[model samples]
Target chain A: DVKVTQSSRYLVKRTGEKVFLECVQDMDHENMFWYRQDPGLGLRLIYFSYDVKMKEKGDIPEGYSVSREKKERFSLILESASTNQTSMYLCASSQGTGSYGYTFGSGTRLTVV
Target chain B: EDQVTQSPEALRLQEGESSSLNCSYTVSGLRGLFWYRQDPGKGPEFLFTLYSAGEEKEKERLKATLTKKESFLHITAPKPEDSATYLCAVRGGYSSASKIIFGSGTRLSIRP
Candidate 1:
């Protein structure tokens, strides 16, 4: 079974603070993704990493950035967290291009006050 | 632009009732379609993946079928535990990394 674990389940931060959400996968997947899920907007991609030190901007990557220093870990960073950045952040990983399914972390609900 | 749309924003069903959830999509090229079940305050759990038209996959009382433009997840004699938000996602062929676009999801409620 594949396991994807997030660093935090819930977090609270003041406005203009820097926030970091970490995700680790045990399956040695090559692709990792970060997304923020909202009520009506659905899960919008924030960033994704295909390999170590390789990153790409997803649809909604303006306020967010990501790091993939290693194959098993991916981190999402908020340069200056604002109240609007509060959301349920999700991390997912998949083995390869041909593999369709993804293993997801439990998610981190961040609250920016 | 690639997109995924799930219909029937919410559903209420009695135990033993049967129904189906719909997911329609438009993309330049289709790589795969995925189904997931999510409870409140939790991340999605992978359920099934449909790679092509005419493909079907099943688990327990849930069955998923795919067509050229849409996919259906049929629940047969559902139970209370089957209540959750069903999500659909599509992988576009343009990216080699298999970037996925997700739908807003359909919330299902089963009462006994």
Candidate 2:
């Protein structure tokens, strides 16, 4: 089974602080994604990377950025964290095009104060 | 707009009770419908993927059936361990992007 690992299970960040959430996946999948899970909002995609050094903006990419320097790792960056950004961040990986589905990591619960 | 919606925001069932959850979608050219189980304070675990209308997949006490406009996740004789949030998602076949739209999810609770 493919294991997607999120670097942190829980994190607290002050407002205006820079935050980095990291995710790594085995099985050499080509597609990786970052999503924020909130009550009543479901899981909204923040960003996705199809290949190394490639990235695409999803519906909720306003307050975030992403890095995909390597094939196995994808990272979500918050240039300046805010209270509204406090939510569960999920990392997922899939094969190219994702016609199948995705395998998700444990997730990082970020509380921005 | 392409979107997915799950019905019955929350449900409470007994251990031997049987029930089904609904997932309706409006995305054109659907490639796949997925069901995932999410425990509290954790990421979702992939459950089943239905590719086409009339396709059905089963694992353990759970079965999923997909139609062109909706999908149903049926849980039979569920256990306490089955209590969690069930999320449904859809993938757009027309687009090359590997992104999926997810529903808010239905929280299920099974009592002994």
Candidate 3:
């Protein structure tokens, strides 16, 4: 089955630490996205990439960055982890024009302390 | 601005109950509306995608219909296994058509 796989399901990081969250897709989609879901705030996009080595900032990309070195893999990086960054992070991928529904990974729940 | 709002943040129904979840949206231009089912601690599973008004799609006990301003996910004869959070999202014809906005979601609980 076509799938988006996130490297970790749960992660704990210390404040000021640099964090990396990895995502890989088997579907060879051209678009990949990173979002953080929080209580009462829903899901907020942090960044997205439409092609390898091409990344764009989403609505909430202040403390985050992304790397799409390869077509099937996208990585989300936290410059410096903070307590406010604790939330469930999701990764999704889509193909073609991206008008279709996305295939999402199970998600990574991260805690910063 | 693009925005999505889902009604009835939480709903509780007995087995065999039928109901609908609402997803209201406003965007520069509507490209697609999507419905997803998310079990606790899991990612959202794609259910349906409606491109225009009056379009409908069905799977098992779930049906999704879209209109110019909103979309609805109707559940018929729901069972306990159907209990999950339903999420609605919209893709707009904005500069970045690839960006999708998601609503807070409706948590549905079906009691057997």
Candidate 4:
């Protein structure tokens, strides 16, 4: 079985504060993704990394960035958190090909006050 | 742009009853369609992946079928434990990588 673990399950941060959400996958998948899920918006992609040091912006990438220094770890960074940034953040990983669906982490609910 | 829409934002069913959830999508070229079950406050758990129109996959009481423009997930004699948010996603087009677009999901509730 594949395991995807997030660094924090819940987090609270003040406005303008820097925040980091970490994710690690044991499957060594080549594709890693960061998504923010809202009530009506579903899961909107924030950023994705296909390989180490390679990143691409998804549909909604404003105020957020990602890092993939290693194959097993992907990190989502909020340069300066705002109240609007509060959301349920999910991390997922998939193989290079388009055959398999993503394996998701438990998700982190971030509250920016 | 690829878009996915799940019908019946919410559903309520009695235990032992059966029903189907619909996922409609429009994309340039379909690569795959996926079904996932998400529990409250948790990430989605993958259920099925349908690649072609006539493909079908099943696990236990849940079965998924695909067509050219949509997919259906049918639950047979559902139990309370089967209650969850069912999500659909599609992967398609040439966007440097395989990017998946997800639907808002249909929340299912089973009454005991």
Candidate 5:
């Protein structure tokens, strides 16, 4: 089955530590997205990459960055993790156009102390 | 800005009870409306996709219908297995890499 895989299911990091969250898609889709889910904010987009090496900021991209060095892998980076950044991070992928539904990863729950 | 809103943040029902969940949205252009079911600690599973008003889709005891302003997911004789958080999302006008907007979600519980 087509799937989006996130490397970590749960993670804990220090306040100033740098964290890396990895995602890989086997569907060969062109668009990959990163979203953070909070209590009342719903799912807020952090960043997304439409093509290899091409990244764009989403609605809530302040504390996060992304890298897509290859077609299948997209990485989310926290330059300096903070307590406020702790949340359930989701990864999703879809074809560039005409794709109906997005295939989402199981999600990574992160905690910063 | 495109926005999707779901009503009744939480709902409780007895097994075999029937009800409907609402998803209201406003967007520049409506490409598609989607319904997903998310069990705790798991990713959202795609359930149905409606492309236009007056469209309907069904699977088992779940049926979804769409209108220009909103969409409804109706459950007929729901079972305990159907308890989960139902999420609604919309894909619309193209400006960003991804145009999909999601609602906060409705958590449903069914008692035996």
Candidate 6:
């Protein structure tokens, strides 16, 4: 089946540490997105990539960045992890301009302390 | 600003109960509306997409209907396995990238 795979299901990080979350998609989609879901806040987009090596900031990209080195892999990076940055991170990919629905990965729940 | 809003934050029902979940949106030139089901500790799974007013779609016991300003997901004879957080999202023409806006979601619980 076509799928988006996240490298980790759960993670624990220390404050000020640099963190890396990896995602890979089996489908050759052109668009990839990173979102953090929080209670009462819903899913807030951090960044998205429309093509390889091309990345754009989403609404909440202050403490995060992204790298799309290959057609199937997109990575999210936290330059300096903070306690408040802890949340469930989701990776998603779409075929075109994102007018259609997206196939999402199982998600990574990161806890920062 | 463009936004999507879901009501009742949560709902509880007995098995075989039928109900509907609401998603209200205020967006410019709506492109599409989407419904997803999310289990605890898992990612959101795509369920349905409604593109225009009067459009409807169904799968098993779940049916979705859309209007100009809102959409409804109607559940018929729900089961315990159907319990999950239902999320609604919308894409708009305000941007070239077709950015999507998501709602807070409505958590549903079914008692057998």
lDDT of candidate 5 over A1-113, digit per residue (tens): 77999999999999999999999999899999999988778789899888999998999998888999999999999999999998999999988886377889999999999
Q: Alpha-carbon error at B21 in model 1, in Å?
A: 0.4
Ranking by DockQ: 2, 1, 6, 4, 3, 5
Expressed as tens digits, the lDDT of each residue in B45-100 for candidate 6 is: 99999999999999999999999999999999999999999999998885557877
Instruction: Determine which window of 10 residues in candidate 2 chain A has minimal summed lDDT.
Output: A93-102
lDDT for residue B71 in candidate 2, whole number 0-100 = 98
* Stretches of candidate 4 exceeding 4 Å from the true structure: B94-96
- Give me candidate 5's TM-score against the actual structure: 0.96
lDDT of 4 by residue, A5-85 (tens): 999999999999999999999988999999999887789999999999999999899999899999999999999999999
Q: lDDT by residue for model 1 over B70-99, one digit each (tens)?
A: 999999999999999999998877667667
What does DockQ give for each predicted structure? Answer: 0.74, 0.77, 0.69, 0.70, 0.60, 0.72
Q: What is the Å distance of residue B9 in model 2 from its true position? A: 0.7
Model 1 chain A weakest lDDT span, ten residues long: A95-104
Estimate, for each residue in B7-65, the C-alpha lDDT of model 3 and write its tens digit: 99999999999999999999877878999999888889999999989999999999999
Candidate 1 — which residues are off by over 4 angstroms? Answer: none
In CAPRI terms, model 6 is classed as: medium
DockQ of the two-chain complex in candidate 1: 0.74
- TM-score (chain A only) of candidate 5: 0.97
What are the candidates' C-alpha RMSDs? 1.1, 1.2, 1.3, 1.1, 1.3, 1.2
Q: Compared to the true structure, candidate 2 yields what TM-score?
A: 0.96
Q: Name the 10 consecutive residues with the lowest summed lDDT in model 3 chain A.
A: A94-103
lDDT minimum window of 10 residues, candidate 1 chain B: B92-101
Q: Any runs in candidate 3 off by more than 4 Å, and if so which?
A: B94-96
TM-score against truth, every candidate:
0.97, 0.96, 0.96, 0.97, 0.96, 0.97
The positional error of residue A79 in candidate 1, measured at the CA in angstroms, is 1.4
